[model samples]
Target: MPEKCGTGLSLLPDVPRPNEPSVGRFGEVLRQYNVRLWAGADLVSVTGTWMQVLGVNWYVLQVTGSSTRMGLAMLVQALPVLLLGPYGGALADRLPVRRILVVTQVLHAVLAAALALAVFADAGLWAIYAVAAVSGVVSAVDGPALGRFGGMVAGPARLGTALAFGSLIHSTGRIVGMAAGGVLVASFGPAPLFLWNAVSFAGVVVALLRVRVADLHPLAAAPREAGAVRAGFAYLLRQPVVLGTLALSFVLGSLGRNYQVTMAAMSDGPLAGGAAGYGLLSAVFAAGTVLGALVAGQRAELTTRLLVGAGLLASALQVVAAFVPGLWAFALVLVPIAAAAVLLDTTVSARVQLDTREDMRGRVLAAVGVVGSLSGMVGAPLLGWLSEVAGPRAALAIGGAVCLAACGLAGARLVRRSEPAVPAALATA
Candidate 1:
C-alpha cells in the first residue's frame, strides 16, 4: 500500500492492490478511451518531434560543416528551458492545462512550418538557430503543461501506468521517427521532414480538443499570486525523497546519459567504426529504450530505491562499455546500458510526479525541465571536451564512475536521514 501525504494524495504504492483487475494494470489503464486517444496522439506527436530533431541536427551539420557549430545550435535551443522553466510550470499550475497544451501545440505546428519554409528557401544557418531558440521557448511551456495534463487524463490512481506508457510511446516514436527521418533526409531533404513534424502537431491538437473535460481529474488551479515559483522550490526543499531523486537525476542526466556525445566519440575514435557504426549504435540504443519502457510499464509502483538502483546499474554498464574491445562489442553493450538509462529516467519522472501535490505538480516538473536543460548544456560540452582530451573511453569511464559515486552517496544519505520522506508541513496538514 502507498502512504498518503498530508494533501491526502497517495505516494508511490509498494504493491499491487488486492482488487487490481486480472487483465493487468497497464492494460486496464489502456482500456480507458481517453488514455487510448491521448496515447495515440502523443505517439504521433512524439514521432514527428523526433523526426524534426533528426532533420534539424542534420541540416545544421550540413550548413556549418562543423560539429562545434552544430553543438552551439543545440545549446541555443536549450537556453529557454533553463531560463523559463519555472515560469512555465507556474503557468501550468495557474491555468487550465488542456488550454495551455492546445495553445502550445498550435505554436509548435506554426514554428515547425516556419522552419520548413526557411529550409525550402535555402536560408542560412541563422534561420535554423532562430527557429531552434523560439521552439525551445514554446517547449519550455509545453513540457510542464503536458506533464501535468497526463495526470489529469489518467487520474491520480492510474498515473504511474499512464506515465510508463508515455515512456514507451516516446521510445517507440524515437525509433520510427529517426529511422524514417534518416531515409527521408537521404532521399528528399530536411524541409519535408520539418513539414511532416508540423502536421504531426495537429494530431495532438485534435486529440486534446476531443478529450472529455468531465473525465479528467483536474486539480483546483493554484490562485494567481506572486512567489508561486518560489513556493514550488520551497515545497521541494521540504520533501527529502523528491529532492534526493532530483539530485540523483541531475548527476545521472548530466554525466552518465550523454550517450549522443559519448557514443559518437566511441564510434569515430575508440571503436574505429565511423558514421555507419554510429548509426547502428543509435538504432540499437533506441531499441533498448523500448525494451526498458515495456518492462517499466508493467511495474505496480516506482520508488526511490528503484530510481537509485537503476542509476547504479546504468553507471556500471557504462563503465563496462568504456572498455569493450571493438565496434560489435560496444554496440552489444549499449542495449543494457540504454535499458537501464530509460528505467532510471522513467522511475525519476514517476517519483517526481507522484510525490508532489497535485496543484504543484507542474512547477515541480518545471524544475525537472530546468535540471534536464542544465544537464544537457553542461554535460554535452564537458563530455565532448573530455572525449577530445582524455579519449572517448576515458570520458565514458569517468562519467560512469561519477554517477556511480553520486548514487552510492545518495543511497547512504537516505539510510542516514532520520526525517520522514514527506514534508513536515504537508504531513501535519
Candidate 2:
C-alpha cells in the first residue's frame, strides 16, 4: 500500500476562518440554545435509525431474495420526502416547529417499535414494505421541521457552526449505528436491531420534550398570509442569488457526491472486495464526513473560500478514488473525501440560512430539501444503469468532473458579487 499523505492532501485550502466572532465572545450558541442537548438527542435517534436502515435493507433482501423488491423498498422509504417536502415546509412555517418535531419523533418511535414487533412475529416482505412506507411519510413531514429547527437552536450568527454540529452528529450517528446494526444482525438478527432503533427514538422524544418552546423564535407575518405560496415562488424568481444557490445545491446533491452508491459498486465490481469491502468503504467515507464537521466547527463562520475549496477537493478525491488501483488506495482517498464532504455540505447549508429571511425560512429550507431529494431520485436510476453499462469508474469520473465544473461556476459567482447576495424580495427583512 502506498503511504497516504492523508494529512498533507492540500488540494484546496483545508478550511477558512469563519465570518462570526468567537463563540465565547458573542455568547456561544452552545450556551444560549443549549444546543448540545438537542444535538445529542438527534445524534442518538438518527444513529439508531441508520442502524435499522442497514438491518431493514439486509432483511428485505434476505427474505425476498429479490434485488428488485429491495430497491423498491428503498424507494418507498424515500417517496414521502419526494411527495411532501413542499407541503411539509409550509406546515413547518404554519405550525410551531418544536411541537411538530415532538409529534414526528413520537411517530418514528412507534414506527420503529412496530417494525421490531412485526419482525419478531415473522412478518412477510410486503408487510415490511408497508411499514417502511409509513415511516417514510412520517419522515417527509419531519425533515423540513428539523431543518428549520437550526435557526431556533443557534440563531443567525452561530447558525453555520450549529448546523455543522448537526452534520457531524449525522455522520457519526450513521457510522455508529451502521456498525452496530451490522454486529447485531450478525449476532441476533434484524429484529433486535430495530428494537434498539425504537429505543434510540425514545431518547430523541425525551430531548425534544425538554426543549423550551418559548426559546424558539417564530416565523414572521407575510409567510402566514393566504397567497404565501405564490409569493414564495415569485421570491425565488426575482432573486438571482437564491436561484443560483438552489441550482448549485440541486446539482451538487444530484451529481456531486454520489460516491456512496459508486463506492458500494466499486468495492465489489472493480475492486473485488464484495460485502466486507463495501462495509469498509462506507466506514472510510463516513470518517471523511466526520473530519469535515470537526474542521467546520472550529471555524466561527463559513466563508466563500472554504466552500470553493471543499468542492474542489470533493471533485478531485472522487476522480482519484475512481482510478485508484487497489482497495487500500481507494480507502485511503476517503479521508480527504470525508473532509471535503462535510466542508461543502455544512457551508452550503449555512449559506442558505444566511441568505434567507426568518419568515420564509420554512419554505426556503423545504425547497432545498425538495431539490436535494429530487436530485437523489434522478441520480439513483441513472447512476445505477450507467455503472451497470459503463462500469463504476466511468460513472464516478464523469460525475466528479461535472460536479467540479459546478463548483467552479458557483465560486466565480461568489467572487464577482459585491453584495451579501441574498434573495432580493426577502432581503428587506
Candidate 3:
C-alpha cells in the first residue's frame, strides 16, 4: 500500500527504499556456508513434502470420491498441531534444534515409507489415517523446531532475506512437486510419489549433518519450568499486534485456505480435469507466492497496514475467483490470490521474528500454529460440507465473503485506533 514517489501505479509496500541495498541482496546471504547448505537441502525436502501431500489428497479422492472425506483427511493431519503444538514449542526452546530436526526428518522418512507400503498393499482408510495421525504428531514437534532453526541459519541481520529466499524455494518446490506428482500419479500411481518422498529426506539429513553448528546464533535454552506453556500464552496476551496477525491466519486458514479439499473438487468437477490440472493450478498459485515473497523480503519493516491490506486484497481476489467462468480464468485469478496470501504470510512471519525475543520465537510460532490448526479442524469439514451441499463456487464465494467481512471489521478497528481523537464538545457540536 505504499505509494511510489512520482509513480501513478499503486505499488505493494515493503519494496526496498532508495537507500536500501540491491534487490537481490539475498545472494550475499547465500554466501554463508551453513545457509547455503541448508537452503539446498530444504528445497529438496520441501518439494518431496508437497509431492506426498498432493499424492495423499489425490488418493483419497480416488478411493472415496468425497469432498467430505478429503476434509476428514486434512482434519486428521491438523489435529495434532491443535493438541500438542504448545508442548512442541516449549521443547524447541529447550532443545538443540539441529538434533531435534535430524530426528524429525528420519521420522518423516519412515512414515512416508510406511504410507507407500500401505498404499501398495491396498491398505484400508484406517491404515492411512493411522499414518497421518502419527505424522501429525511428529509435525507438531518438528514445525516449531524447524521454524526457529530456519531463522538461525543466516543470523538476524540477514534474516528477512534468508526467509524470503526460503519462501522462494518453498514455492518453487511446490511448483515442481505438484507438476511431477501429477505426471507420476497419472502414469505410475501415487505409490511412487510417497516412496520418492521417503527418499527425499536424505538430502535434509545430510545438510543438517554438514551444517557448522558453531556458526549458529543460538538462543539460550529456556530453563525447565512447571507452566511454560501458560507462560507462552501469557506473553502472547500482552502482544496485541502479534495476536491480531494470528487471528487473521486462523480466519483465513480455516475458511479460505482449505484448497486441498476445494481445489481437488474444483479440478475434477468444475474444471473438468484430473490430477494434471490440479498440478497446473498448484504451480500457478506457487508462482504467485514466489513473487510475493520476493517483494516481502525487500522491505526492512512490516506494519499492521501491510498485513490488513494484503488480507483484504487476497479475500477480494478469492471472491472474484469464485465467479470465474473457466479453469484457465480461475487459474489467472489464483495468481494474485496467492500473491496476496504469501505477502500476508511473509509479512506476519517477519514481523513476528523481528518483535519476539529469540528464546520465545518457537513458542510464539507454536501458539500461532495451534490457532491455525484449531480453526482448520472445524473449518475443513464444515467447508467440505458446504461444498457438498452448495457446490464449490458457493463454498468459495461464502468463505471469501466471510474472510472479507472479518478483514473489513479488523481493518476498521485498526483505522479507528490510528485516527486522531476529537474533543468531546466539538464532536457533539
Candidate 4:
C-alpha cells in the first residue's frame, strides 16, 4: 500500500493542500465562487456532450450494423488529435485561453448543429465521417486550452481542486447524459440529441464571458518560435514522473479506455441490447467514475504506484467483467471497473497539471493528447477487428491481456531503473 499524508488520501502523492478552513478534502477548493460557477456550467455542457456521444455511437451502430464501422468512426475522430494536437498546444501557449475557449465552444456548437442538419436531411456515411473529422480537428486545438483553462479560473493554488471538481462534474454529466440519451434517442432520434448538445455549448460560452479576467493569474504568452513544439517535447522527455504517467496513459488508453467501442460491441453482440441498455451501462459506468473522482479528490498527493495499481485493478476488473453471464451481472462488475478507471485517469490528469510549468502546461498536455490519440488510433480498430473476428468477449479478453502486459513491462522498466549496475572489475575477478 502507498503511504498517505496527514490528509489521509494518497491516490497520488504530493498534491498541494488548500489552506482555507473547510471540513472535507474539496472544501477549500469549492469555496471559490468562480470555480463553483465554472463547474456548474461545465456540468451542463458535459451532459449535452455525452448525449451527443451516445447518439453518435448508436446512430452509427444502427446505420452500419457493424462494429468495424463504429471503430472507423472513432478512428476518424482521433486523427486530428494524433496529428495537430501539439501545434494546438503551442497555440494555447501564445493565445488568450479565454478567447480560445469561447471560440472553440462556438465552433463545437456550430458543428454539432450542422451535423444535426445533415442527419435530418438523410446525409450519407461520408458526410457523417466528414463532420466527425471536422469535430476532431476542433478538439485537437480545444482540448489543451480547455485543460489549462481550469488553472486560469481557479488560480494555481487551487489547480488540483479545480481539476478534481472538473472531473467530478464531467462524471455527473455522463450519468445524466448517458442515462437520458438512450431514452431520448429511442423516442425521438439522433437529430434532437445533436441540437441539445449545440444548445449546451452556450452554457460554457456564457460562463467564460462571466469570468473576471483581472482575477486570472495568467501566464505570459510564449513567444512564437520555430522550435516551440519541439521545446515542449524536450521538456516533457526530461521529467521522469510525467514520462511514466504518459506511458501508462498510452497503454491503458489504448487497451482499456476505448469504452465507447467496447461497450457498444458488448451491448449489441452479447447482451442484444438496444439504446436503453447501452444507456444503463453508460450510467452505471459514470456512477462508478463519480465515486472514484470523489475519492481521488481527497488525496493531496499523486504517485506512480497509485497510477499503476489503479490501472492494473481496472484492467483486471475488465477481465472479470468479460466472463459475466448476464447483463445485470456485467453491470454489477462495471462499478469497480469505472472506479478504477476514473482513479487512474484523474490521477494522470492532475499529475500533469501539477507537475508541468504554467507556461508549458498546455503543450505538455497536448503532447499527452497525441499519445492518447495514437493509442486510440491503434486500439479502436484493433479491438473492433478482434471483436469482428472472434466476438465481443474476445475483444474484452484481448484488451485486458494487453493491459496486463503493459503493466508488467512498465513494472520491469521501473525495476531496472532501481537496480545497481554491475562493476566491470568485480565481474572480471
Candidate 5:
C-alpha cells in the first residue's frame, strides 16, 4: 500500500504533499512509479492510435480522392460513441476500471489487426468502415474507463498534474506517430501502420498488469441499477459549471477542432503539399500540445475563467491559421493554435473530474465522450462538405468564428454570475 499524506490521502512516497511548493508539480507527479508506468504505456498506445488515424484518412483519400469520403469515415467511427457512450460510462462506474481497460485494450488490438488484414487483402471501403465502427464501440467504453483510472492512479490531489502529463504523452505520441506514418505511407502503405498499431496495445496491457492495485485510490463501485445512464445526466444538470463546460466543449470540439478534416483537404488542395504536408502540420500541432501540457501541469488549480480564456485564444488562432498563404506558414500557425487547444481540453477535463462525485465520475466522463462523438459526427461531415464547397479556408474560418462567438458568450456569463464555480460540496470533497 502507498503511504498516507498529511491530508490522509493514499499517496506514493514520491508524491508531493498538498502544502509543498507547486513550482515543479509536473515533475513531482511523475515521480510516482505507477504514474510513470501508465505514462509509458499510454505513450505507446496513443502513438499507435495516431498512426492508425493517419493511415485511415490517407487510405480513404488515396482511394476515393474526396475530402467528403474522409469525413464520412470519421463520422462512421464516431457514430457508435454517440449512440452507446452513456452505457459504456455506466459500465465504467460499475466495473473495476483496470479490468475493464485490459479487456477494451485487447479488443482494440483485435480490431486493429482486422483492419490491417482488410488492407492487406485490398478489401472494399466497407471493410474500412466496419473496422472503424467496431473500434468506436471499443472506444466508447475505453475512454471513460481510462479517464476514471487516471484519478485512481494519481489520487485527487495530483490529478490535475497527472492529466496534464497524460496530454504530454498523447501529444508526444501524435508527434512521433504522425511523422512516421507520413514517411512510411509514402514508401509503403497503410497496412504496415495498422499492424504496428495492433502490436502497441501489448504495452498498455502489460502496464496494467504490473500496476500495484493496492496503491490505487479507487472509488467504491456503483451498484447495478436501472436509469444509471439517466442518473449521470441528472447529476450533470445539477452542476452548472460542469454542465456549462461540457456545452462549451461540444461547440469547440465540433467546430474549432475538426483539423483532421480541414488539414487533409488543405494539404491535398490549396497547399499541394500532399501527404508530407499533412504529416508535418499534424506533428507541429502535437508539439504545441506538449508545450501546452507542460504549462498546464504547473498550475495547482483550474477555474472556469481559465477554461473559457483558453478556448477564446485557440479560436482566435484558428482564424489566423485559416488565411496562411503557404503550407509552412499554415503549419507554423498551428503550433500556438494546438497549444491553446491543449489548454482548453485539459482545463475542461480537470474541471469535470474534480467537480464530480467519485461514483458519478465515470458516467460524467462517458457523457463527455458522447459529446465528443456527437461533435465529430456533426462536425466532420459539415466541415467536409464546407471544404468541398467554399474550400478548406472557408471551413476553418467559419468554424473558428462560431467557436469564438460561443466562448465569448460563455465567458461573459461567467462574469455576470460572479458566483463560485466549484460547488461547496465538491470543493470540500
Candidate 6:
C-alpha cells in the first residue's frame, strides 16, 4: 500500500528468509553437508544383499531342518571376515579406496547374479553354500574399503552423522528386502528373490562409478613393517579404550546377535505362525534398527558411557524379548534390541574414527571388523547347537545372560575409567 508511491519508497512485504545463512545451491548441500547421492544409490543396492541373506538362511534350513546347519551356513559367510578383514582394511588404505570399491562392488554383483541364476536353474544346496562361502571371502575385501569410503565421502566433521544415515538407509533396506523375500519365496519360490538381488547389485555399481575422485583422497599404497598386520593389533593392545570397545563387539557379535535364525525357529515353532510371522518379526526388528540409526544421527559423540550402557541394555533386551508372553508383546522387545545394537555399533565406530590417525584408519577398521566377525563365528554355532537341543528359548537365555555379565564386568570398568570426567554421560548406559 505504501509502495514507492512517488520515489521508490514503498514498503515491500517482508519475505521470510532462513534464520540460518544461505546454504548455497542444491549441489552445495551434498558438498557441505556430506550428502552424496551415490551413498543413497549404494544403500538401494544393499536391499538386494539383505534379500539374499534371508533366502540363503531359509534355503539351508529347508534342506537340513537343523539349527546347527543354519549356523554352519552363517559361519561360512562370516568366517572370511574373521580371518582376512584386517588385511582388507589395510589394502583399502594402501590403494585408492575408490578404485578398490569399484572392483569389489563389481565382483560382489557378479557373485550375487551367479547365485540367482544357479538357484533359478535348480542347483544343489552345496552350490548355494559354495557361492556363499566364496562371496564371503570377497566381502573381506569389499566391506572395509566401503567403510573407509564412508569417512572419505562425509569427511571427519560429519562422520558420525554420515554413519548414522548410512545405518538408517541400510536397516530400512534390509527390512523391506527381507519382507519382500519372505513373500516372494512363498509365491514364486527363492529363485526370483535371488534374481532380484542380482539386479540390485547393478544399482550400487553405477553409484560407485558416478562418485568423483575430487571428493575422495587417494588411498595410496603404503609400505609398513614386516608385521604391518600386527601393527594394528599392537596399537589396540596399548589402548584399553579400543580394546574394551572391541571386546564388546566380540561378545555381541558372537553370542548376543543370532536372533534372526532363532526368531525364525521361534516364530514357526512357538508362535505357531509360518512365513508371514517370520517376515513380520524381521520387519519389526529392522524397524527398530532404523529408529536406532535415526537416534544415533542426532548424537554428538560415542562416549564411554554410551559404549558400556548400550551393551548392557542390549543384553537385557535379548533376555526380556525371549521371555515375553504373547506374540505382540514379545515383538515389541525388538525395538530396544535394534536400538541397543545400533548404539553399540555407533559407540565403537565413532570411537575408532575419533582416535585413529588418518593413515591407519583402514587397518584399524579392518581389525575391528575381524574381531567382530570372528566372535560371531564362535558364538553363532554354539547358539545354534543350544537351540537344537534345549530349544530357541534356552539358547537365547544363555546368550543373553553371558552378554549382560560381560557388559557389566568389562564394559563397566572401561566406561568408568574413560568417562569419570563427565559422570552424567553415563546415562547412555
Candidate 2, 5: how far from true, in Å? Answer: 45
Question: Which lDDT values do the candidates have, in the order given?
Answer: 0.81, 0.72, 0.77, 0.76, 0.81, 0.69
Q: Of 1 and 5, which scores higher on TM-score?
A: 1
Better of 3 and 4 by TM-score: 3
Q: For model 1, which pairs clash?
A: none
Candidate 3 residue pairs that clash: none
Error of 2 at 309 (Å): 2.9
Q: What is the lDDT of residue 169 in candidate 5?
A: 86
Structure candidate 2, residue pairs in collision: 18-301, 19-301, 288-338, 289-338
**TM-score against truth, every candidate:** 0.92, 0.87, 0.84, 0.83, 0.87, 0.82
Backbone collision count in every prediction? Answer: 0, 4, 0, 9, 0, 5
Error of 1 at 251 (Å): 0.8
Q: Tell me, by TM-score, which candidate is best.
A: 1
Q: Model 5 off-target regions past 4 Å?
A: 1-21, 264-279, 322-330, 384-395, 415-429
**Top candidate, metric lDDT:** 1
Cα displacement (angstroms), candidate 2, residue 21, comes to 8.4
Which 10-residue window of candidate 5 scores lowest in summed lDDT?
A: 420-429
How many angstroms is residue 147 displaced in model 4 relative to the true structure, after the best TM-score fit? 1.1
lDDT of 2 by residue, 277-396 (tens): 987888888888888877776665465556777888888778777899988899998788878778777776766555655556676777777777777877777777779999999988
Candidate 6, residue 81: Cα displacement in angstroms equals: 1.9
Off by over 4 Å in 4: 1-23, 61-67, 260-280, 322-327, 387-398, 408-429
Q: Summarize candidate 4's per-residue lDDT along 283-310 as a digit string, tens digits.
A: 7888888888776766554455666778
Worst 10 residues of 4 by lDDT: 420-429
For model 1, residues 114-224, the per-residue Cα lDDT tens digits are 999999998888888998999889989998999888877876666656666788899999988998999999999999999999999899999999998887766656789
lDDT per residue, candidate 3, 1-429, as tens digits? 111111111232433343555556666677789988998898888889889988998889899998668667777888888889999999998888889999999999999999999999999788888999999999999999988888767665556567667788889898888789889999988999999999999999999998898887666567789998888788777766567667777888878777766777788778876888886787788788888877766655445676788888888888888888888998898888877777777666766655565667779878877876877676777777888899988888999999998788778765344323211111100
Order the numbered candidates by lDDT, best leading.
1, 5, 3, 4, 2, 6
